[model samples]
Target: MSEIISLAAANQHLQYIDPGTGNSSGISEMLAPSACLNAAEKKLAFLYLDNSVSSIAAFWNFFNSNHACALLSSSMKQEFKDSLETLYQPHFIYDIKRESVDGYTMEKINSSLEIFISRISSGYSVHDELKILLSTSGTTGSPKFVKLSEKNLVSNTKSILEYLPVQSSDVTPLNLPIHYSYGLSVFITNSVKGGKIICTTKDILQREFWSDFEKYQCTSLAGVPYVYETLFRTGFTKKKFISLKYMTQAGGKLNEKLVDVFSQFAEDHNVRFFIMYGQTEATARMSFLAPEYLQQKKMSIGKAIAGGRFEVDPVLHELLYFGENVFGGYAESWKDLNSYRQELPLHTGDMATVDAAGFYFITGRIKRIVKLFGNRINLDEIEKVLNEQFHDSSFICTGLEDQVLLVGVKNFQDDEKIISHFLHSKFSIHPSVIRIKQVEHIPLTDNQKVNYTKFMEQHGD
Candidate 1:
């Protein structure tokens, strides 16, 4: 006999508490039934899931019920919004405010519950051909919608959970935005294991993060490389995160020196620092470097997850993934799912190599490498070398036709000193340093990826 799975059975404690205000709501309370009404209802669901686990639960619940929903980030721009409205023609918009939601304008639809009940009573399967639409990082081109299905999510979540074990007692701080893949996985994984998820809408880079950690006794914290850089700059001492058990870094490769510093800091405070790797195309995580092997394999993205296997091409050196969790091919439009194929393994555009011990270390993106003077130069390598020289500063290395441009965001005097130090350092090749305008901050994508394409477009020749 087939097993029956209900939301209450799956998640025993279905109440998701907002850490910011201590407001608690049942899983059903946060959801609007009317949001899932048919095409003729003229009603749409606009979900703003910021620091609220209920928002995530509601989204999944509605999505699994065959309702159409759009993921909106707190930092979405007007251009992106205009494009989405024109394309989806969504009636309702889930406005996620970076700040407080006080005085925000949204239509108060009253028949949401009635619409939801009517749909559920009709015996509709929410998971049937579900569509999850997301915008790309807009690094290479305009951000486009990535449509995924219920199978895609369930497969990815199951595979990831097999690798990273999350117990029921584990409390994960919902730090990253749910609109992004990384943040969404945190919710999916934790919810599957019946663990407690603490919701905090405030940016973890801000001052309010430490207090929330203390209040919630959060066990795990996950972020991108830049987030860790911010914590280091904000003078976040080791004593501040006494309750933290494990911290994972992903979204982008972190500096090796910064990794060493974080490993030490976590050691002092009795926490495990995990170096993880993933992209939206493969769900959130593909592999994670264990805390114990971090020192020896400091730069490795570790081995593949339990059910997944990774191989590097002998000729091209590109990393390839083979697993069920791999997404069902890309879709240009929502109706194109019929033409999507599940054949062939996923080819990640990253160049990587496996060590003698079987640990996979990503060298860099295949396109990010520059051929200057007949010698191939990896921008990531130059960035790593520069990071080793300057501990606290942020640097982005981009390739020009004949030279590699190193952009440093630091104090004027310190920038010069760091540049001088890098020039003297022994790398296989040395590029000319062009000191551009010193800025207070580096621009990052919605997923916390360094906006390299944007940087080149705005600053490069």
Candidate 2:
């Protein structure tokens, strides 16, 4: 039997409000389509979802049923989405944008959504423990996915709730997408134990988003580093939201200066600020710097989560994590789903150091090193230096070749020659090998991380 989440009890107190349409509904309403997905046969379903009532209902139905599903963004490109469908050949597909599938019959779930039921099976069996498949490459639509089990989800959720201060009366806006790991955790943690959830597609930059945030009196805000950066640049910290009790940051390392700025703001306002660290491989979170120690240990990733532990490889200095939430390996094709392979003691690929208090600091990425002119360079370090120097701009560094490095900058007003000159003067990097590309905004994957893959493609690399 599947370890399905029974909403019978949670439904009584769970209230879902969609600010877009001014609609308020109970969790029980999400169960209306449960029968369509609860068929006795075990199958795989593809759920392309957005933050909306219908999408939530479909996702809950598939999750509660015995079926295994892959959660994808509804905004995925049609060709990329079609490619995955052809590769996995899922038995069912729920997409807000799709009208029909080649060998499937369509059922209209709502005005904005439809369900596609395949006419024939793909002749593949899904592992009993496989419950969710999250894309490894985010919006790039790579076939690689991290496989997660029900135990992984439950364990991570419990661990997060242990440290995150959320209450039954709190209200939170779904500021992030549901497909991203951090975003999914925000939704699940709030749904299972927190309080009322406001479902909206509006992002932080939109005026309508702030309007809804104020109208609903959102109690908590969750964001990645990019989101936080945008908030700080937009004078968000200067303003006050009385309903906001706390804030959560993850997805990437926020600059130390900005971390201190936000920590001080949170302190003055009596709001808790949690700096967390994790990857999709570990479900969502592996560690979090507690609000109490934010000022003293602003650079630390803090201690391990409630049930997770971290270790640094003696030789490589790479960060390692051990926990129930560690994913059951990865899936690149449908055939790989035949069984679950637990690749434990996850090497996080990040080089880190731990202090006497057991607090961890991420130094750099092991894979981010590149050879340029017989000198090894760390791309992450270059980015950190440039970002700190050019506080008004954002920089992403990538080595394209043995002697060539590309620096992608956004919101930069200075001459490109200045960047090259600075690199040559400071790092002894020759100007001939330094390439600079400026953009109005740095391209971000659907999950809101720097889209290095897309950025590289822009240069035809």
Candidate 3:
């Protein structure tokens, strides 16, 4: 067992608080009822979790047990959820949202949570070292899962803690979904401090979220680029949260202008603002820019996390990371779970360059390039250009071998001509190859990332 999980399970000072009901329960007490699961042999369990105490308690219950668990979102579509259930054939299905599965008998753990036990054996052997399975596709419900072991989780947790200042007296809110890698790391890292964790489904846009945050005196916050954008538009910089000591951003890159704005805000308010870089394959974080360097290196991802090293491929210029936290491997089916692949020297698909001081900056994704008229055009660069130009709109840029498909969301459909003129003026690309479409809302993956794959599928024909 990992030391972090063991510490959390045994710590009586660690409490999971439900802000909705103002109820609090110690970790030992919350995890006590599910001790029967630990008696079982090595098996596979599917955990559909949310941001509530019952769901988190159920997760810790299975995590501490010998069984390997797959973390999934509770709000996943029924068909997609059923597809995964059919594909994996897990022996146990612990669901917080659904009532039952077709081939499984439901057993209630609490009023809001239940475990479905399979009627027949799955006849599949799960590797002993596999601790957790996280989906690579955010909300797309892809069959692929990144396998993580106890070592990956613990190493990554310790690396993040080496830079983050989490105290036992601090209060952290579970605003992000635990099914996502970033959210899971936040939960595990804070658990080590044995502090009060506020479990709620409320987001920053909700009035209830602020009420609970102020009520509990929450000390820190974390979000992705979109969350920060919403915060900036909603006047977050003007308001003062007396208890906020630090903020962290990851999941995807934030615009350089926004980074500067937040950096200045953090300076003015005496709060630490961290710009982090990570992926699900690394078990959460790979690098973090120290708050002190935000002003000087606003575009850099800073140095690698503790116990990790970063290098760029000389030939391909792709970012490469070597760390104990690299995932075991990817599993797409039941048979894939039988063997654990300890693949190392993770190859991040993004092209990056490291400076003399060792700070890393991602130029673009290697796969996000389109060739048109004998010129290689970066799709990510195009999207960034359009997004920065049109402050009120978001754009998704995708393309084939020689054509570019640009999809705009929010009041920019007729700006196609303007976009074409700009691209022609900027990149010297012909206007005939560029096509634009308008949509009310851009599709997002389960983790709230821009669904570029879906966009390409919809518009790249």
Candidate 4:
């Protein structure tokens, strides 16, 4: 067996605090190398790692023991789990439900554990031929398993740390899942640096969330666009986060209004709001909008990180990323990493343009652009325009056979007034406007992406 180090040894003097409660778990005595070795002897592979920082640290220690490790999000649906079973055929499964660890069925538990232990003892390297499968968010189609190496995870984490700069004194309140590349990166980077990680199961947008932040004295927070949207709705004023030194937003584009609100909030609170851009393919972060230039280049995704470069292909209007942190390739069957150069200088599939200041701003997905009246119109650009005009309204623009349809889900006190305003707005290209009931909840994929395919299937072609 490979030499294993305990989390206590690695994170000496660090205390693991649960933000929801006042309880604290000290690492100096809790995590022992003997416990890790015992767990390893039991053959724990394919553990469903939870979203907490402590669980992530435990998993990392296991991985360091040279066991084949595959991370799965606790939030994955039954269908995704079923698909993963068919592909990887994991020997053991770890379920991270809420803030605790749960075991699997007896038959599954025994057989998988034996198989994983036997294989590891026979000199098989989990980081070598053994697979570490990651599922894509399934925004466009069925989620596929992307195979990665131990080097990929370690290298990517190192690369991100090089640019972001986390110190041991920092405490990151993780709001994202550990199964997710974004969430996983947060856990790994912080733990490796001996930083304090406070685990919380409470929703970050709730009124009680601020109290938890105050209780824990959280210095950093990371979230997706939806999380920030909830904060905006729940009256997230600048005064609440006096202890927060830095914040990050990712998973999707931050609407211009939210960007302005967050920027102003950061200015008042003396906190840095980093607007980052990334996908599952790149293991999480690929680019980050600099906090210093948040006001000057509000919508920009900023530049690439240390080991990555972002370029705009003018001919195709596709943003491409080239970096060592990029995945080897996607796997359809979770058998092995596919040998393909197709993703090199990885085509991000999003349309964007770089300004003279070198800030990159995404316009829309290439597939989302509509050819209207012989002119190309980006749906995202139109949505941005309409959203700015009507703050309380939600809209989606889709292209039909020859005409464009704009569906507005509005919360306007006077719907007619807002519709009339859009009818005369210069941004509107004389397209059809269809007003519908305000959407209480936007359908999202397991990865929190807008489920457009489901939307079209439910609504219309």
What TM-score fits each model?
0.69, 0.80, 0.81, 0.68
Candidate 1: where is the Cα deviation over 4 Å? 1-9, 28-49, 96-130, 138-141, 331-339, 367-461
Better of 3 and 4 by TM-score: 3
Clashing pairs in 4: 47-94, 48-94, 91-112
RMSD each, Å: 11.5, 10.3, 10.0, 11.6
**TM-score of candidate 1 on Cα atoms, chains taken together:** 0.69
Question: Mind giving the per-residue lDDT tens digits that candidate 3 earns over 1-461?
Answer: 55667767665557889998899887666554545676446788999888899888888878867888999888777777888988999989988667667889987665545689899988888998898999865554667799999989999998999999887888999887888899999999888773899999988999999999999999899887767888898999989989998999987778788898899889998899999998889999999999999978878988999999999999999999999999988999888898777776898778899988889998877677554532346577778878898867788777753345454555774546888887766555668888877877787899999888787777667
User: Which residues of candidate 4, in runs, are more than 4 Å off?
Assistant: 1-14, 20-44, 96-132, 138-143, 206-208, 337-343, 367-461
Ranking the candidates on TM-score from highest down gives 3, 2, 1, 4
lDDT (0 to 1) per candidate: 0.61, 0.82, 0.82, 0.61
Highest TM-score: which candidate? 3
Give per-residue CA lDDT, model 1, range 1-461, as digits (tens): 00112432366654466776776555545545533433433223445455565455556454534454556664545454545444444443455442222223333333222111212222122223435655434211122445555566677777767756467777777888777777778777776674667777777666676777777777888877767777787776445665677788887778777898898888788787888887666766788898889888888999887777899989999998876656655543334333334544677778899999999998766666553322334567666766676667777767654244546454445537447455434332433544344556666799999887777766676
The candidate scoring highest on lDDT is 3
Which of 1 and 4 is ahead in TM-score? 1
